[model samples]
Every structure is written in C-alpha cells, then in structure tokens.
Target chain A: MSSVRLLVGTRKGGFVLTSDGKRQDWKVEGPFFAGWEIYHMKGSPVDPDRIWASQSSGWSGQVLQRSDDGGKTWNVAGNKFLYEGEAGTHQWYDGTPHPWEFKRVWHLEPSLSCADTVYAGVEDAAMFKTTDGGTTWNELPGLRKHGTGKDWQPGAGGMCLHSIVIDPTDEQRMFIAISAAGAFRTDDGGGTWKPINKGLHSKYIPNPTAEVGHCVHHIAMHPSKPKTLFMQKHWDVMRTDDAGENWSKVSGNLPTDFGFVIDVHAHEPETIFVVPIKSDSEHFPMEGQLKVFRSKTGGNEWEPLSRGLPQKDCYVNVLRDAMSVDRMDECGIYFGTTGGQVYASPDGGENWQAIVRDLPAVLSVEVQTLP
Target chain B: MVRVELPAHLCRLAGVGHEVTVAVDASPVTIAAVLEVLEHDYPALEGTIREHETKQRRAWLRFFVCEEDWSHIGMDAVLPPAIVSGKQPLLVIGAIAGG
Candidate 1:
C-alpha cells in the first residue's frame, strides 16, 4: 500500500497534507517557513531525500533554501543578491539604488541528472544554474546573450521567470518559460534557446506570435511522454506534442482560458489538471464560480470537478505555483488560491474537497510522498 | 532626523504612544539603525521584528519610508534623503497572515 502526502506552499509559509491509501482522511501540518512568501517548493524528483524552496520577504528580499532531511531543517545558499547594492559590490543593472535590493528567486528546481545541480528562475527574468548544490551559480549563456540587460521590462508582477521543465529521461533537453517572454527550449542544455511561441495568444499584441507579450504562466509535462506538454499561457491554454515546435488551443471546454497553473498526472500521461479564471474583467473565476478542470485524455477534453467545493459565490485566483500533482500512484491533485483557500482532489480531480480555508494567499504547492 | 510611527501592534510593544524619532544624517538610512532605535526605545519590539532563534527579520513585518517600501532595503544601508528630512514617516506595517 503506497501512501501519499501533499506539500503546499503559500505566501506566509507551507503545509503538508498527509493521507492514508484510502484518501478519505487528511492531516494538515504547518505553516513551514512561516511568514515568508514561499513561491515554490519540491522534493527532488530524482532524490526524494533532498528538498528545495524559494522564499521572498516582501521587503526583506528573497532567499533560496534547501533541506536535505526533508522539511525538518533548512540552510541558505550562496551570497544574497540584493535589488540594490553598495558603491562597488554590485547593483541592479538598472541603477535603482535602495537600502537593500536583490533579485527574487521565484522558482527553484534540482536537476534530474545531478543531485547537486540546481536551477533558479529569478524575478529579473534571468535563469541561474548551480552544479555544486547551490554553493555557487552562473547565469545561463542563452539568457545572457538575449542581453535584455538592465532594461528587462517587468510585467504586472515584474519580469518573473516562473517555470523550468527538464526532460527527466534526457537531462540535456530543457524547457524554460518566462512571464512576458513566452516559452523557450534548448536541446543542448543551456547552450542555445529558441522562442517556441508559434500558436500562443497575447492580449497585448495584435500578432501574438511575433510579439514578446505571449506570457506563459506555467508548463506541465506528461511523465511518460517527453515530447507532450501543456502550458497555461497568459490568455489561453495550449498543448504541444512536438516538444513545443507548435502549440494549439485546448481550452475549448473551460469557462475561461486565463489561469496561472496546470499539472499532469504522475503516472497517467494523458491526464492533466488546471484552474480556470475569467479574463478581461477582474481576473476572477467566471461568474465567481471556482472550478478545477481535468482532462484525462490530454487536452482534447475537460470536465469541471468540484463535488465537495463551496456552493456560494467564490472568486479566487490560483497562482502559477499553487497547484500540483503528488508522486503517488493515484496522484492526489492539490491547489491553493489568492483567497487563502486550498482544495484537494484525491482521485486526480474525479472529486474535490477543501482541506484548509482562510490561510493567506497561496503562492505554490508541491507534494512528496514520504518514505 | 526623521520620525517613525509604529503600527499599533509595534507601538504597544514599544510602549510609546506618539512616534519615535531617530537621528539619521545620511540620504539613505540603514535598516540596522532604525531597528536599533526601535529596539532601544521599546526592547520588546526587537524580538517580534526578528526571529528569536536566527535573529533574521520576521516575515510578517514590513518597513516603509514615506510611500516607498523599505522592506527590501539592506539592514546596514543608509536611509534615503526624503525619509531623513521628515518628508515621510518611517512606517512599519504588519502583514496579515492565514487563509
């Protein structure tokens, strides 16, 4: 009997949802990193013993922390990069001087091939790679070449680099998505990158393909099929089977295409999950109805699964890192929203239940089944 | 020198009713000095501002100078000129946590 656990990350801390094989009863523990804006957290897919988290201190700045012994203890890595720096140390390329300034690491992932290898997607829209377990890091060559440099324009939430997906079977193949830069992939590790935004729609652009505003909020990959992927684009939901060579809209059944997070089943390559929100208006759910849509046959179809959800009017926006699928065979699906509520689906969205309510805006969710 | 007004939560801890003034001669005042005065005048506020075990700033508290948020400012960095000149009050805000 394999057990399952859900690790949820929020603006103030993180929570662990534990369940028996039955998935009926659940136990929630903690506000881990209590009081920090934990954007992302995950136990290494390759090595479950190691865990990493990206936390931002509204004004204190951001820090990347790692835990080797699960979530019991944590340690910070590298020199803290400030948004502003002293006379000679280093300053934000933009020269925006301040008392303390540093780049905020919005997402962190451990490499699939090297346990010590780590990657961080920063708020400055840059990617940093570490080979020695985050002791030191270097910006990727491809991003450096783009040289948007100091003038890297930030979107509504700043120039955020949110998602990085590495083909687990082939470590050299990687996909990275920036908020306003669409999506890019490199077959040769970070040596080269090409924008794969052929079919994505950008509300800010008359021609979404040729413009840089086709922002990608998140990306999900089928565990068994490396070439198949799903992305929550700024204005649409997209699917690509040729490793992002092209994309097609797959949100026909959804109420609205504007959402931040998407997830794929850990074992079922065809199964996927998404949270839908209204577009153009206030960015809330359509008619204030919060629903989690799942497509068991890839993105060809979708079904709203909210059996145990609230029946009253509810408006909430789930962040990019707030929804996730656990590592269990059945794979419990979990998500949190800006309204400070968390809902879980034990049977991969066949049914839903609220685990906790009124917590703080949930920023991210990660699930790891403990050994 | 700029006067800083603490929120009710912090003010109660500091035991001062109105505001506490700190002398800052530079343009950008360091967070460390502001915290030092806050701790000196109302020692109880120090432990609340930072974690007791690690001594790091608490995640729920934020600092501001005028309309600009100073939470990202370095602990040892200087306060900006506008804040030192009393054009803005160094404001401390407590972030709301929980769902």
Candidate 2:
C-alpha cells in the first residue's frame, strides 16, 4: 500500500503529516525547527526520504536544512547566499534604483530526476540552486542580470521569486515567477531567459500591460503537458497554450478573479483548481464564505466545490505557495490557509477535510506520494 | 580559556549548552578573537551571531562583558582583564524585541 507524506511550512515552524493510502486518520508530527519561520519544505521526487526546508528568522537571517532520513532528523545545510558578480540594483517602490538584497527563501523545488539538486526562489528576487544536497548554494546570475531587472519593482510582499516550474519533458527548460516583476522562462537550463508575461494586464501599475512590471501572484503547470500553463494573477485567472509566448484570460465564470493559488489535477492536464478571494484590498473570501472552484475544461467555466468547506464566516487567505496536488491513484489535492488550517481532498475536490487545525499560519505546503 | 553564554535559540542551533568555553591563544585577546574561536568550534554558529560578509553583530543581538554593553564597542578592542582571566563570561543576548 502507498502512503502520503505532507511537508508543511508555517510561520512558527514545520510539520510533517503522514497517512496510509486510505488518506484518512493522519498522524501529525512536529513543530520541527520550532519558533523559526519555515518558508518552504519539499521532498525530492526521485528520493522521498530526501527533504529540504528553508528555516529563517528576522533576528538571524536564513538557515537551510536537509533531512535524509525523512523528517525524523535534520541537519543545518549552508546558509550563505552571496550574489555572483557585483550585486546590482532593482526598482524601488518610488521608482528609484535599490540595491539587490538577500532575504528569506520563498520556495524550494527539488529536481525531478536528482534528489541532490534543488532550486530556491528567494526574496529580493533571485534564483539559487544546490546541486549537492544542500551543502552549498550558487546563484544562477543570468536571470537577475537579464535586461529589465532594474525595472522589476517590489510588491506588497517584498519582491520575491516565489514560483518555480520545471519542465518535465525537457530538463533544460524551466519557468520562474516573481511578484511585481512577472514571469520568465529559461531555455538553456537557467543560463538565458525571456519574459513571458504577454496579455497580463494590471491596472495598478503605471502601464497596464508592461513587459516586466506585472505582479503575477502564482503559476502552475501540469507535468504531462509542459506547454500548457495556468496562472492566477493579482486579479485575473489566465492560461497559456503556446508555452507562454502569449496568454489569454480564461477566468470564465469565476465569481472574482482575485486569487493566490492555482493548481492542475494529477492525471488530467485540463482540469484545474483555484480559491477565489474578494479583491486585492480585501484578501478574504467573498461574503466570508470559503470555497474551492474547479474547472474541468481548463479555465473558462468554474464550479464551486463547497462540500465540507466553510460556507459562512470563514476569513482565511490562501498564500501563493500554499497549494499542492499529490499523484495518488485517486489524485489528492491539498492547500493551507493563513488561518492555520490545512485542508485535504482525498478524492479530488469533491469533498474536503482538515488535516490539522490551529497551526501557526501555514506558509507553504508540499506533498509526496510514496510507495 | 574564556567562558561564554549564548542565547537559548543559538545554543540549540550550535548544539551546545547555555554556557561554553573557548580557548583564545592570541597575544591580545579581543572580542573578535573570542568569536573567531567560538565560530570555529561550532561552525553552525557562523552566520547567526554576526553577518558572514560584514562580521558585524546582528541587529537583534547584543554583546555584554560582566553587564557592560560591549556590543557597540569595536570588535578589535582588547577584552577586559576579568573577561580575559575567565572570571566573567561573555554574554551573547537576543534583544528584548518582537513577540
């Protein structure tokens, strides 16, 4: 029988949730790395035992942690994240040049083929990779050095590179997204990159459709169909069919397009999920009712999946990196909320149940389907 | 040998007790020399007490020698006789801030 392991990062610490293939009766373990801000935790796809966690604190900067024996034990990996060349400047909120700085890591994406390789997207917006487990980190300078970096301004969340999607078909190609800077794709394995934010319009920015100043909230890609991608921007739900050469709004019938999370089903590439919020000024759900909307045909028409979810008086926000899907036989979907609740839908989005309630405001969630 | 006291969080990170001792062999014992020895003994404490590049004390951390605030003093300043003689322990404390 297969088992599922959930690696959850929270503002207070990290928690590990485990359950057998039945997906019921979970055993929640930890407040591991207690009292530290765990921005993200992820297990390698090739080796389930290998896990990487980003532990950070306002008092003490960043600390990278690695676990080889699952989550039972952890060792502090390298914390040094120096920029490659002379660290240049980016756009400040006042349209002035601001020096690039290293803050806490926002996301960790383990290599699909190698457990020792992992990529880290960090605040102040830069991409770093650790090829040998997590001992050392080297920045792939091309993305930051690429033209228009100076124009990439910070969002409300402090300019962060939060989303990373690796192409399953070609390892050399991958996509990364930054807040207030839009999305970029690297064709030659992080060496060279290009902006892929066409058709994304934001009214808040000076130019509604600028090349690199759009604040993209989050992006999702199904492994089987690398060319097709889904995006949940600050205000609109979008899709790109031609590998991000261009994009068109596919919000369809969603109540309000303002959302933070967007994800694809494990087996079905066209099927997707999103939790719509009220608006940018109001981060809570519409009418204080929590719901998850599913689109069977990509993104035009969405149906609310409210079974077992809070229908009234629920005011929790789902962060950009807080949703994930497990590749179980039945396809399990999971998401964490700012109110410290992690909800799981074992049989897709038809039904929902909370795995753990009253954690310290989850920051990110990643699931591993183990045999 | 000089005695040192670390904050609870840093003690856990360095895998050490609240109070630990480090031997400084330099002729003139400075605060920087003690920290160098302490960091060498526990590599995990490298970027915790001080920034890696600047070697400056973290904003939320304070250094004390027998209740005298040594945090604002220069790192290269010679240590007091009592601290050098192991009579007083160097205190690395987290500032009283945050929730």
Candidate 3:
C-alpha cells in the first residue's frame, strides 16, 4: 500500500507525520531541531526523501537544514542571504523610510522537476533560490527592486513574501505574494516581475485600488489548471482565471470571508477549501466553533465541513501556510491549527480527524504522497 | 587555547558540548579573534552569534567574562587576564527574555 508523509513546521520545531493511504493510523517523528522556530519545511517533488527546513530564532537568526535520508537526519545548509546590490529602503510602519534588512524565511517551495533546486520566500519581503540543493541561496532581486517597493508597507505580520507558486506547465513563469504588497508575477524566470493585482481592493491602504499595497494572506493553484488561482486576502476570498491578470471576489455565502488559508483540491480543480475565522481583529472561528468551508463550484457557493471538527467552544486559528493536500486517488486534505492540532480529511473535506494534538502551534504543513 | 561556554541552543547547533576550546592567533586575544576561530571551526555557527556581513553581535545574545557583562564591550578589546589565561571560560548566553 502507498503512504503519505506530512512535514509540519511549528513555533517550537518541526515534526514528520507518516501514515498509510487509509490516512487513519499515523506515526509521529519529531520536534526535530527542538526548541527552535521552524517556519517551513518542504520535500522535493522528484525526490521525496530530500527535505529542507527553515530553522530560526530571535537570538540566533536563521539556519537552513537539509535532510537527504528523508527526515532521519539533517545537516545545516547555507543561511547567508545577501541582496544582489545595495539594500534599499521601504516604508516603515510609521510611513518613514526604513532600510531593508534580512529577516527570517517564511516559506519554501521545492522545484517541480529538480530535487536540488528550491525557492525561499523571506521577510522584509524578498525571493531567493538555491539550485545546488540547499548549499547556497541567491536573491532574484527584480521582485524587490520594483518601482513601487518603497510604497509597500507591512501588514499585521511583517512585510514577508509568504506565498510562492510555480507554473507547472511553463517552467519560466512564477507567482509570489507579499503581505500588504499584493501579488507579483515573473515570466522570465525571476529576471523580472510585475504586480498582478489589477482587481484587488483593500480598504486599509490609502488607495484601495492602487498598483500594489494589498495584504494577500495566501494563494493556491492546482497543477492541472495553473492559470486559475485562489487567494485568501486580508479580508476577502478571491479567484482569478487569467493567471492573476485580474481577480474577483468569490467569498459569497461564507459566514465570514476573513481568514488565512486557501487551497485547491487535488483531483477536482474547481473544488477548494478555506477556514473562515471571525475577522481580522478576532482571529478565531465564528461563535468559538472551528469549521472548514468547502466550495465545490470554486467560490460564490460554500458549505461548512464540521463533522469530526470542534463544533463549540473551539477558538484555534489556522495560519496561512498551515493547510495542504496529498495527490491521492481520494485526495486527502490536511491542516494544522494554532492550538496544536493537525487535522486530516482522507476523503476531501467531508470528514476530519486530528492526527496529532498538543504538539505546538503549527506554522506550516506540507504533504507528500509516496508510491 | 581558550575555553568558551555556549548557550544550550548554540551548543546543540554546533554539535558541541557546553564548553569547547579554540586556539586564537590574534595578539592579546580579543573577543572578535576568538569568535573568528570559533566560526571557522564550526561553520554551522557562522551567522548565529554574529551577523554574516555586519559582524555585529546578535541583540538577544550576551557575552560574559568573570561575572561581568561583556556584551557591549568592544569586540577588539583584550580579554580579561582570567579569561586569557584559561582560568575562566568566556560565556555566551541568551539574554533573559520571552514569556
């Protein structure tokens, strides 16, 4: 029987959870790099055994770790992320110009074809890539050097390039989203980029329909339909059919569209999932009841998936990168919570169960289906 | 040879024990010289205690020698006699923080 592995990054550390295709019985492996903040962990698509983790701390800065033998052992990779040219300035929280500085890595996206290549999305909002495994990282400076960079400001979270999606159909095309700066696209393999937020509107910024200052929480794309993308912005759930040329609100019927995570289903391209929180101020589920909403027709219509989930008095929040899916025949869905629970739905979002509870506040979750 | 004690997390990261010894070649044996040798020996600790480019000490880490806080001292200043003579170890500690 085939199996699946879930690489989970938490505030405290990283954990590896493995289970058969049945998705019921599980084996939990870590708290690896224990006591350090693991912001993200991902495995290569071509080589599932190879994994990379972003280990960091306020006192120690950042350390990149790579595992060759699955999650059995790990070695520290290069952590030095220097800008291509002079590091410039961007708008600070008080609207003052502040120098750009390197912070922590927020997300990692392994290459779709090569095991040795990976992309890192980092705070102070920049993009970096490593082609020789994780030994070195070079910044793709065009994204940060855009004309409107100085006008970009931080969201509630710091200014971070938190989401990255590569076009499986076209290797040179890619998409990245930065908090409070809207979404950007690169068609020449990271050499250049342009803001793709044509129809996005954020009431928080001075210009709601400006070229770039929208806080995009997370964006998702299915492999088959790379042009169609789903996004969970700061206050709205949206979708785009022309590969982010434009986006429209598809948040209809959601009790509250304000949430962090959004992901496309494995087998069904039109199906998607979102965990709706009460609002930006209150980062918990509505009525203190945890729920995962599924939209089968891709946005305007949604239904609550509450069976096996906490129905009352549960206030855990799901983070932006905390949700994922495995490419199984039945398509298993997975997500982690701020309350330290990793929930799984083997049969899409109809039912769910916690694989492990009381581990740590999960920052990210990535699943790999092994043959 | 100089004796240096690292914080628990750094020790784990460097795959070393609480205390490790290093030989410094700089005259008068300054803190920067010792750290240069330490990072050279343990590449995993390259950007942890200090910034990779700026070479500035991380804000959350403090340096101590002979019960005195040496965190804010000049990196090139000569080590105290007790520390220079290996009678006492230079301690790298995480500042008291976090909830």
lDDT values, one for every candidate: 0.72, 0.92, 0.94
Per-model DockQ: 0.06, 0.70, 0.89
> Model 1, B12-71: lDDT tens per residue?
434577578877544446667667666666544544565433456667788776687777
lDDT of 1 by residue, A71-175 (tens): 677776552432222212212334352221235788887887678898888866667788888666677756534433332344566667888899978888888
Q: What's the C-alpha lDDT at position A180 in model 3?
A: 82
Candidate 3, residues A11-71: lDDT per residue as tens digits? 9999999999999999999989998999999999889999999999999999999999899
Q: Would you list the clashing residue pairs of candidate 3?
A: A180-A215
Which stretches of candidate 2 lie above 4 Å from their native place?
none
DockQ of 2: 0.70
Q: TM-score (0 to 1) of chain B, per candidate?
A: 0.76, 0.96, 0.96
lDDT string, candidate 2, A1-371, tens digits: 99999999999899999999888889999999888899999998898998999998877779888999899999989988888998899999999999998988999999999988999999989999989888889999999998999999999999999999999999889999999899999989899999999999999998899999988999999998999999999999999998899999999999999999999999999999999999999999999889999999998989999888888899999999899999998999999999999999999999999989999999899999999
